[model samples]
Target: MAIEDNPSREALEFEGQTTVIHDYAAKLVPGILQTEAYAREVLGSGARPKSDEERDRLLSTRLARAGILGDFHSPVMWSLLDEAVLRRPIGGPAVMCHQLRHIAALGEQRRVRLHVLPFEVGAHSLLDGIVSLMWFEDLPPIAYVEGLRTGRAPFCS
Candidate 1:
């Protein structure tokens, strides 16, 4: 018998099939752009933390998703982040610095077009949650909305 049930795997497949990835993160950084250390810190902490083994599996999948960014036909990633996400500093200053540097490096390489939505911008449409929009050349776009602990991928026809 075969049992196939994994939301993360489905999410990864959705991400992998896209030709362009445009995301707006209101609080935390997008998972695809997260560094290994930052991802580990996030996966290990939280209200209902996972076991080390579980965290490892999740980390591996997250990293694999990041790997797609380096592929020959990688999607063009555009990310807009809230200023709060930068100031909040996850995993301490050192880890935050590393994460920031990693993002900067990606921008420099033109792998991602990064934008910072300053706090002064005040409230906006996407202020309530993270929105990820993936575009495909031949198929309809997929918009994924994620909150603190939940997410929904809605397809518009």
Candidate 2:
């Protein structure tokens, strides 16, 4: 599921840190790191949006969320991506090239750390879904998992 699908006010208010494990095979991207073209394609294609307008609205929201990454109190973010994510051309060659370059640029920034899990790693744990963990200064961490068309945040010890 896309971050746009999870319009939680709490997530917007969060000001701390975040860690993400992303497998593009599951059809999702780490929101703070997606390019406009890449996000447009993913959100538009997968949701079968009712109309172009709706798709644009959703895409806008998703892209807006990325703005938090640029805020003065932005969270320190780390993203681990499956190698397949770098290989997949979600929006054709030009779009993908731009997306990858964007990711590379983010890595050059001080606030984000990006890593790729090469296929050579073979099979291991966390193959079940995409996971995102957010840690806040004054609240318990929250974990969000995505599978198929749904997502859940099961908060417990």
Candidate 3:
């Protein structure tokens, strides 16, 4: 399938594909890797969902995106996270503890690889924002950068 920019969370898909996620999170955990409680906290603080029902629906969708990681034929996932991602306490200490443990568990999975970029690494190439690169057999590699507004662009391999 041809790759496309996905600004809408509901339409994002990695399913049974090879995906590489590199994120520099200064605020909260990355969306695809967030726990339910973590996601709710992150979303709640920023989006200001009109009602609890809407928030739940959005949270459910975020959780559903995680389904691909555990499917029968799961995708190859490589997540490179900044060390700062672990330092932020988005939903209090308990939530952060759970989230960190969850991330470690996910990293232990066969199809998932997690790398943490230490703060001592100093200046680096990817210092700007969160970037996700999706690879498919038939189409050229596509990349997405997250910021004030997400933009889909091609990252030349």
Model 1 lDDT per residue over 38-154, tens place? 878877776886878878877787688788888758899999999998888899999999999999999998899999999999988888867889998888998877554455676
Give the per-residue lDDT digits (tens) of candidate 2, residues 1-157.
4545544223443422443322233234565567889878876675444478766765676677677767546776777788877888989999999988888877787556777778898887776656667776556777766543445564534
Best by lDDT: 1
Lowest lDDT 10-residue stretch of candidate 1: 1-10
Regarding TM-score, does 2 or 3 come out ahead? Answer: 2
Candidate 3 lDDT tens digits, 92-145? 999999999989988776546888888899888777777777777766666756
Which candidate should be chosen as best, given TM-score against the real structure?
A: 1
- What's the ranking of the predictions by lDDT, best on top? 1, 3, 2
lDDT of each: 0.80, 0.63, 0.66
What is every candidate's alpha-carbon RMSD to the true fold? 2.4, 3.9, 4.1
- Cα error, candidate 3, residue 144 (Å): 2.0
- For residue 95, model 2's alpha carbon misses the true position, in angstroms, by 0.7
